[model samples]
Target chain A: MSSITSSKKHPLFWVLLLIITVVTLFPIYWISVTSLKSPVEVISSRPTMLPQAPTLENYVSVVKSGFFRNMFNSLLVAVSATLLSLTLSTLASYALVRHNFPYRGNSLFLVWVLVVKILPPVVLAIPLYSVFIKMGLLNSRLGLIFVYQVYTLPYCIWMIFGFLKALPETFEEAAMIDGAGRFYILTRIVLPLARTGIIATSIFSVIAAWDEFLFALLFIRTPSLQTLPLVIVNYIGEYETLWGELMGIGLLTTLPVLFFSSYVYKYYTQGFSVSLK
Target chain B: MTQNKYQKSCFFYLILLPAVLVMLWLTIYPVLNVFTLSFFKYNYLSDEKVFVGLGNYIKLLKENLFMEAFRNTLVFSVLATAGEVILGIALALLFYGHFRGKKSFMIIAIFPMMVSSMVICAVWKTLYHYDIGLINFLLRETGAQPVGWLIDQSKALFSVVIIDVWQWTPFAFIMMQAAMGSIPEEIFEAAQIDGASYMKTVFSITMPILSDQIMLLIMLRTIDTFKLFGKVYALTQGGPGNSTETLSYYIYREGFSYFNLGKASTASIFVLLVVAGISFIYIGKILKKD
Candidate 1:
């Protein structure tokens, strides 16, 4: 036990930690380096660990290929999905936690939500395609946001459910005794107390919506309507892969998520613990 | 007062209505639609639909490609989940106690999982390239023959699995570390005071205590990996003779690429059943706790 506690002081431990860190981060480093290399250097038989002559030509080419439009599409869809799902789940989970429904409706709803979360999106995408086509939602950003609820809504419900359940009911009860209405109590007291959980849930919702590929691939037909992931995949063609441009866009797609996760790293991990519980 | 209580209850239900309606429209309606669609021989482009009466299911059962995709999905899910959880446990144990730079180390370590799977796959695809890949470059530097990572049928699935493991192992590590943090330090101290060796203490005390969290982690990983689509779509595209074909990819091709909506619907039903079954067990466990 003493030895286990003291192991951090040993050189072998630090060496092992450093090696694991490098292996984990090597892909990000490689993409950054690859994205900086010129096209001719990108295809060299001997890959350079470092760019021989660093250039932003690949970034410029990617931008010229309409990367920014796709990025804006991704941002629009992700933000809307996050906001929509967050609002819906917060209200629903609050109701489920504070007020009981007959016939185990609350638990049954949660069970169904979990099932939707677990099932592959492809399963739902098949039928949703037909419905969207009929509704004239194909190639529309609003449809993506609606369909994204399948991913984001269930998650928000679960994460918020966990947070709301952990909150003490006494505050709400006291507020009610003071003639505060349910809506006012939820907005002022409960929501403020669960601020960390809401932020964490919103972060995850944005990430899931941003990274979504299959539904966007299926529903969105117009090239201009395509999201970032759709554009990133287009760079990898059968006959020729634009390695530098692909890596360039790949790095760009990763930056927002990396920034969010690192910014609130503590709440990010806390979100995981809450959901797992 | 009685009317006020009734209104209060109505308000709760009112707030719950939107989520219920959205879920019903999205999940319940679509699932039912898939079931109905599975009974027909339909092609979207042709605008033709004929009642098939389980014909699609029969065809999928006998089709080699569908079976291969099923098997590959299972193998990928099992192998990736096992690899991640095992490696995750090891990393958790290694970094158990307080150390300088732990916060930064953890943030960097989890970078793989935070990034989009498409981006991660792009990086790995380049690294797995036969001629100009960094892995092969290192192999050549070490006087070893260059291997066909994505081109070879036999090794292609494993290569994809390696990418999955590399990208997701940190998730398992985080889960395991959080679980480990919850265990009381006094237990380990008690084991030490009783003259138990480090390995013995870990096996006896820590393993038994963390068994529940471990099971939960495994189930979570298994469910996620079973939907393995983005990695295969980006890396192999079910390439080199259907070596890495997965259920989701198969459904995608049938539904979209080929426009065989009936067959795709049947495949979707199959996936839905399996995923639902697994998640029910998980849900039962979770709800039981509540």
Candidate 2:
């Protein structure tokens, strides 16, 4: 506090910080402008700080096509994966924390889930493709949902487990003394008590599922089933003309995520900080 | 209604049973399955599975493209990881002094990171467009020619590396900032009184104190970077003649595009070894600390 108070009197530091902030943010700002610019303005040899005329043409084109369908696909996979992973990871972590069981040394089996995070998706692609093919889940939204669980489940467990450890055991015991069943206690007591952690976990899961690309690219091939991230890239060109629409779609895809986080950023991103440390 | 203690324990294990099974089948089974396929030459559509005994491994070792991918991955990972960590530290330092705009500035700084990697890549891909990119536009104002951003074989990997830095530097920043806040300000004050300059204080006092967190960031970043599928898929397509082909992209093409399970599996094992080796070190540290 003292250091901060003394340092603030310096004009140079504030100016330098402002410059750094602009450098850090220039790309996102530029993209936003590009997405809003007219076709001619975007492709013009000279760059314009402001668009010649802002147009929603790219946004309209994307929406009129399968873009909504793609967003829907992303929605389906992300929600299903978050719900499934949360349920399983919560139950598993509950069992670990509340019960004494045989083979408990493998309490570390949950630790192995982090292994999936490290295992490259490419390695999983070949065999998982076969597995899903036999199960008839390829190109299905459920397939990517199932795959995303593999990525997010470890996080869910480790995180929820941290919250459970921090919670008082007396509440669960009190419920047990009242003749409440384990299932009832879990649903009513543990779940309710862990609300902040669960919500944080879910938000993180949603972002992960939304942003996921490689699996969606491989697993979902149909235009309707493709996720937003996949479709946004499809409209872009390697040698190209219009930069504006590309920027617009890019901004569109990221807008909801930023809003959701700012709304609950304290709970969600902060949880990541705790779990990571 | 008197259940034995052992029976209650059994019930708990039973509750855990389905989850364990699913995770095993989904994660572990595929890993082992990839292992089995690595030694075999299974055609994409064929019913026959021929075991070729280290044949694919031999083929990869002899292939120039495989070596190039291995080299490219290491270079990209090292540079990208280092860039994010260093940049993260610098940004964290920027926020050390109290400023009215620090909070808004941070949110904006992390904006690139919060968006989906695919979306960010789409934006950056346009910015890197040789003809119309702002980067080139800026360069031209100084009388310089447009730099080859993504199109040229030589600069393609560099462009991808730059995107990774932009997206992930915030992660490093966030982690380090959290760590920095925890370091008792008094400790920093004592170093200041000991006649340390700002740079000396950070290099000696701040960095050494935050080394563990920095290493943790490096580990986390490495695992994610090793997965490097999004940007490459979005940007290069392993192209300008496969100049930017990475291991994950190679495996993806082999497995999904070509349906060449054998080589894909081999490549998968290669990636697994690299990641697993790094993880073992971290796991050991975590366990030892416990």
Candidate 3:
């Protein structure tokens, strides 16, 4: 992969790249500008390329209207889901990679997990909603956390399994030769070495749980219990035509994932490429 | 050694037990529940339950709304997946040559995919508004009649597809770029030395080599685009006479808004079958390759 580097250049390449970048990034730029604009400019007939009177009024309103509470709800669900999924899947992937189960090798188990990952959320949502209602989990944060495992756990197993598969088994073997227990070998030898993979896996889990809309929309009814995506939807309805504040909340919803994606930029790409292979 | 091996196997089952049970409980139990629920006439609001025995499926097959939702979902998935893959290949090809600031350009280009789909729809919703939208404003400046991008029945579905293409094409581009990057430089250099033109290299060399990756990406995008909900919810809510009503939205409304569990479960099973079919092809291909 590293052997290929084409130095061929043309003015056409530069122009095309410029156009593509502009087209791709323009919406984000426009939304940021709208968030900073006064309401008068937001609904103006002629769209301004830049904000005329840049103000924090929209962002201020968003915060003053208890945006942080919803933010906390989103964070709590996403974090809890990530932690639980990571621990469970780490153990699961370890077992699959290192040991045999009844009548099959680990590939079947891996494929089973992948199937869960690929299943449509709506297919799960209906049954889960009814089940949650019966169990008194409706509109509860704990309910959302449990349901998010349907989304987070499978992917966690898939990626972490790949990481563990690629890792040389010698370290674990040496520890085993010294009579280290499986749990000790895992915690003392495996987890630290697989730190980057764990982070990459968790980022996806957090993002999936955080940005989930369908389950959050169906499962949570109370406004205070809603996540960020639900709050953004509610803002769309309550502040109908209040484009400025709506865009403000929209930006708030997007910025964290953007920062997280960029923070793990290297591993994010690597992890995806590895999983594809 | 035998005792140790047996002990190790015990440890394996012990370690695997929690995730296995949880996944099975979450996945298998709910799937089975939905499957069985499809056979009964159940409504969440009225606490009514009765045996339907293919009644919901028969009714849905005759329901125009369900048919329309199915048709819209199929159309959206095909168009959006094709558009994203084609545009992604084009974008990747355009930026194949090394240049200054390429890394930053890629970072900026992939920003759309990193943002939430709901947020992207919100941004596009403003741009697609009838009168004051920036798109219409530009049209007016050009002396063209303004288009109702999302408000017209014939245009609403396509408009939603455009937003999807905008958001997800970057995924295809990133995957293809990585695949293209892995090809050794000598292959291209060899083709160039053999007097092959750039177009020939792309068509004859680059494409054939990248075909597997392209196929994988197409399958992934196809599966994802089939679950079209967030954009429709945030943008049009399947309005303009239900032109943008996808299967996911239809299922959501039936299950949540009306509390018709039977019909919703029926539709959900239809979706599950289609998705399982698509994924089976993908998984079969991967397993065969290995």
Candidate 4:
């Protein structure tokens, strides 16, 4: 409150904010510009303050060399994981939220889910690697989807748990009074209200699958099935570097998440990740 | 009606069955698998799974790489987490008393927190490069000798810590701000009336109230940092003589790079124990409070 009073007279806050915003955005903007500039312009000791003739050469190379296919593979896997996790989490959250069964000590169980999330991903890597190898699930999209879904479903469950806590059970009770079945009410009444929350959770899942590298790098071996993160990493050859192309792929890769989150980031769906991370 | 009720209950569990089973398969199975594999000297390629009970674990106990990775992980997590929490609180306090550009500052603050780790690493990797890098360029202008950020064995872990601080301080800020907002204004005013200065009010009244939330942030960041893979992978690849290799990175190299299945599994159990210990303390407190 005092800040509201002081902000009018003191412009220092404005200056500080502007400086921070510029600093926060500089790397992103720099990467974008670097992706556009030619090899010469990118590596020049002097700043290429602005692209003189911005070109899509780097983007073309990334695309024509079949990088987009890998990107599509990531998109497919991320979407599948997000959708599956959301479906399961929504149902579990609904039951936990609206129903109080004889054995309804659900909060303790939810903490178990949180513990699952806290378990280091590294711990599972070794054993899961062997499991995938034995099951012939290595380098398969379906297998990757299964892995990624379990990775973030606990998060999905936790997110929906928080969302469901604030919503009154009366709404579902009202639907029950109107002679609607529990499943019907869940689908038609409660879910639509929780749409924003669900969307937020799905975005988190998608980004987790998309941006994931270690699992993708370890599990995938076939060049045809590699995800975009692997492509970006491997494109940095064992020899002479390709900075421009790396930045190009990096921008292209995260663009969807960036666009989606920029629109959706303000939602109250920030979860264990923001807290846990 | 009784039969219908039982049937509905069965159906509910059935719906839950897939998720529960998958969770068991992916999470529970692998964790148990790590324990089993730790006892066996197994190779992924050679198809020779010989159970040499506790042999791999015994070897890892004496391994220098495991020792270094373990010590480095503890130091890195402690230093980085403490730094992030303090800096995060400072950023939160600086922004707590809002200004004209509060909304804008917040959006920018959360911006870094929202971006992918790999992308952030790429940018920071460039910025930390010794030759033709922004950091060294700034230092040179100030008449300071350029230092090797990622290459120097002693400094690599600190360099990665700095990257983490840059990306994650916003998280601490948001949580701390939320905790601060919970304190009543009159309590602060009452303290002020008792001849407390700003520092005293903050230290005596505000900070004590904020201690639990600070503890929560510390637990979260420390566990997260212990799982450091992206920054190390991007910045150094655990290079310059394995100076920056944490347990997680060691697990990766052992499991993937070398395919040392038994050893990797042994290392993973070590990670699992540390992670479980941290969560038990923090999550136990959180659950108990509820």
DockQ score for candidate 4: 0.44
Q: Please give, for residues A45-155, the per-residue lDDT of candidate 4 as tens digits.
A: 654557878999988987878987888898899999889888888887776765554555477567767777887687888777778888989889878887885577888
Q: lDDT winner among the candidates?
A: 1
Tell me the spans in candidate 3 whose CA falls farther than 4 Å from its real position: A1-8, A263-265, A268-277
Query: For model 2, how does the per-residue alpha-carbon lDDT over B178-250 read when each residue is reduced to its tens digit?
Result: 6787788887778778766777778888899988878778888887777777788778888887788889888
What candidate 1 gets wrong by more than 4 Å, as runs, is A268-277
Which rank order by DockQ, best down to worst?
1, 2, 3, 4
Per-model RMSD to reference: 1.7, 2.4, 2.4, 3.0
Provide all candidates' interface root-mean-square deviations. 2.1, 2.9, 3.5, 3.3
Clashing pairs in 2: A34-A244, A35-A244
The total of clashing pairs for model 4 equals 0
What is the DockQ score of candidate 2, to 2 decimals?
0.57
Residue A218 C-alpha lDDT in model 1: 85
Compared with the true structure, what per-residue lDDT tens digits does model 2 show for residues A67-115?
6677777888898899998988888888877776556544567558667
Model 3: how far is B13 from its true place, Å? 1.0
lDDT of 3 at A158: 79
Native A-B interface contacts kept, per candidate: 0.71, 0.61, 0.61, 0.39
Candidate 3 lDDT tens digits, A13-126: 678777888899899998899999999998999999999889999999989988899899999999998899999999999998888787775777777777776777888887
